[model samples]
Target: MSTQPPSAPVAEPPPAGWEEARSRVYAVGLAAALPSTPRPLAEADGHTLAEPLTTRTDLPAFPTSSVDGWAVRGEQPWRVVGRVLAGSTPAPLTSDGTTVEIATGAMVPEGTTAIVRIEHSARDPEGLVTGVPRPRPEWRLPGEEARAGEELVASGTPVDPALIGLAASCGQDTLQVRRPPRAALLVFGDELLTSGPPADGRVRDSLGPSVPSWLRRYGCQVRAADVVGPVADTLPAHVAALRSALGTADLVCTTGGTMHGPVDHLHPALEALGADHVVNTVAVRPGFPMLLARVTSDDGRVRFVAGLPGNPQSAVVALVSLVAPLLAGLQGRQLPVLPQVTLAEPVPGRGDYTHLALVRLDRATGTAYPVRHVGSAMLRGLAGADGFAVIPPGTSGSVGDRVRVVPLPLLPGERTW
Candidate 1:
């Protein structure tokens, strides 16, 4: 059976609301360490560009046929002299009463006035063309979508598949994007097993497989080399893991050991390392023991460490509170904007702390309903949840009350719908 260890000397309870706790970390400016670098376009998806995308060639470099049709000079009832398919050279039509058969995307024949749709044209026994052309030109003129040297997309744009396609259309093979912030994980718990199911009073380590997935979703690059293990519950082991992770990681995440339990060594270990706290404990339910700190590497590079609680659900909540915004800023991505939704039923908040409830969303109606089995140690609730619904300190929200919902990990500029 699990036991509650002696309480850590409670620091004065954090300012009484979730915003105050999050604002404290936001004020520290944690984004300076991540840098920008030129990256190949193929591999740069999800990165924010550090420079504008300038076109190397005019969009539709040649006059392009928008429809498969006959390229006519002026009048119909003309002779079909040649045929032009996409990528094929077309015989120039220089005189009136002459036409050339053309396929979609084929370059327009020189001196051609417009395209007559194949459905609107007919060939007589003598190979004479007869049709009334559409009023508008059915060909895209060069530079219609973009001109060479034009700025197609501004700097700081997030690169998605569509943006990548845009860059490729503009003749770019590569782009400059902010380098992904590198993070390392250190899961701390002597009772956690690396493999197999929970048995004999030891549980499986969930953070190793789960937390890194979250980090990657938020645009962080978690290298496999830096993931240390379920270190033994000892100060020396904790300190050793901390120092080793600080050596190469911009951010090191330590799971468990934030409290004052006999086995909890993160607080004392961090103190021994002269680390400064960014957020010691937040005034939030289920994950209040979460901690963020700044520590300098032996080589003088500044690094960060976040201590997550032992409970599986609480640890993930802490991650959403601390790491999500921090990584967004560090990766040069915009802070995520929380979506507001109506509650499907009444939910109460903790008297001294804010409550976050995992919820399922009816996106079509913009309403949130609480999920079941949501204790700190339980992961079942989160597995079926869409996002967290914020219930502020000292207040309750009834059905139809508007509340802010923090979305699960999303790509930049992606809409919840």
Candidate 2:
């Protein structure tokens, strides 16, 4: 008979405002699915690991030569016995007075303790050399870098290129990683069209064109994006478009038609589809109207929908604050908090709002300066930005004050500043 008591259920709190609601949403959103199937090491870049990796074989499996030199026993003018090429397994290196010419990366002969460069040794027909009186241990011993069966990498680590090299050295031909989530972007606005030749007060559909690329950079497999007109009188078309997207996507991100007004029909549409609002608004400036919702399809599978501000800059900030972290979590990534940095200029008055200021880091001075343009609707400001400095709510900073800055997603080979 089982003696364990039934676990008591804790009381659940009601979702309050944005911060509390978002925290709850993230708790539920994080890596709900187990990581995806294992992939070959060749295809694992940009993927998150499903399981920890241990070394199968020692790095530099045997004592190997570190330089193009002569492998010898003790010091001194010695006779050349034989040569050991990189691939050939030489007979057990067992001579003290004799030397063997060993190429770089070749296995060090069994008995040779030190390696002397070929240039340092004089060759003669009789195979005797001088000036090489003492031999130093130049051999890179087996398992010196990493031993077999050691924990090479932890589970859920993003497969950075260096980790790939480590995996290869550990004899791993493949890795297990989370599957990239599939998503669709829908931009709703009658005044917007794709950029080209704009006519009659119409603006380009910025979110549709730009957001997908950003999503891809964060590891989302964005399948498609479309621009739908803002139909104030009837939002059925928009709702239908969203339903269609939900059919094939794990998430659907939309821009515009989110704020409170007669034309703001996204809220009602979401309610009609049985979606629950995780956050109706965020506290961050330039992204104050951002909203996130989680919905269950008719068959009970969950999906996420983020409603971003129509302005390009606001949309970008909202994505960074909400989407990036959420996606990273879902992909089994362990993202560290932004490292702190010092500001190069004073920002005194902007204290009421949580600010996300675009900034560039000075490589020479190790300082970060906020960029000039920070208007919510501005795109040019973001174009010149490398990363952002976060100013926490109710506090301002002076020129030399340090603040935390989050970096933009960098490509595999890019250097971090």
Per-residue alpha-carbon lDDT of candidate 2 for residues 1-417, written as tens digits (9 for 90 to 100): 989999899653332433343355456567355348979888888778878888897877998887887887765667788889998898766667777888999998887767887676676776676545235566788889888888878876778789888888788898878777787888777787676866899887777777888887777777544334343334786678778787877767888877756766787788877888767777776677877788886766778888888888888877877777667667766644677788899654345566778888886777888888778888887888877788877877679888877677665457685
What are the per-residue Cα lDDT tens digits for candidate 1 across 24-132?
Answer: 5544534453567888889998787778989998888989999998999877688888889998877788899888889999999899987899999889999999988
Off by over 4 Å in 2: 1-26, 75-77, 129-136, 223-234, 298-300, 348-352, 415-417
CA lDDT of each prediction against the hidden true structure = 0.83, 0.75
TM-score for each model: 0.87, 0.87
Please tell me which predicted candidate would have the highest TM-score against the true structure. Answer: 1
> Under the 3 Å rule for N, CA and C atoms, how many clashes does model 1 have?
0
Model 2 residue 312 lDDT score: 83
lDDT of 2: 0.75
Predicted model with the maximum lDDT: 1
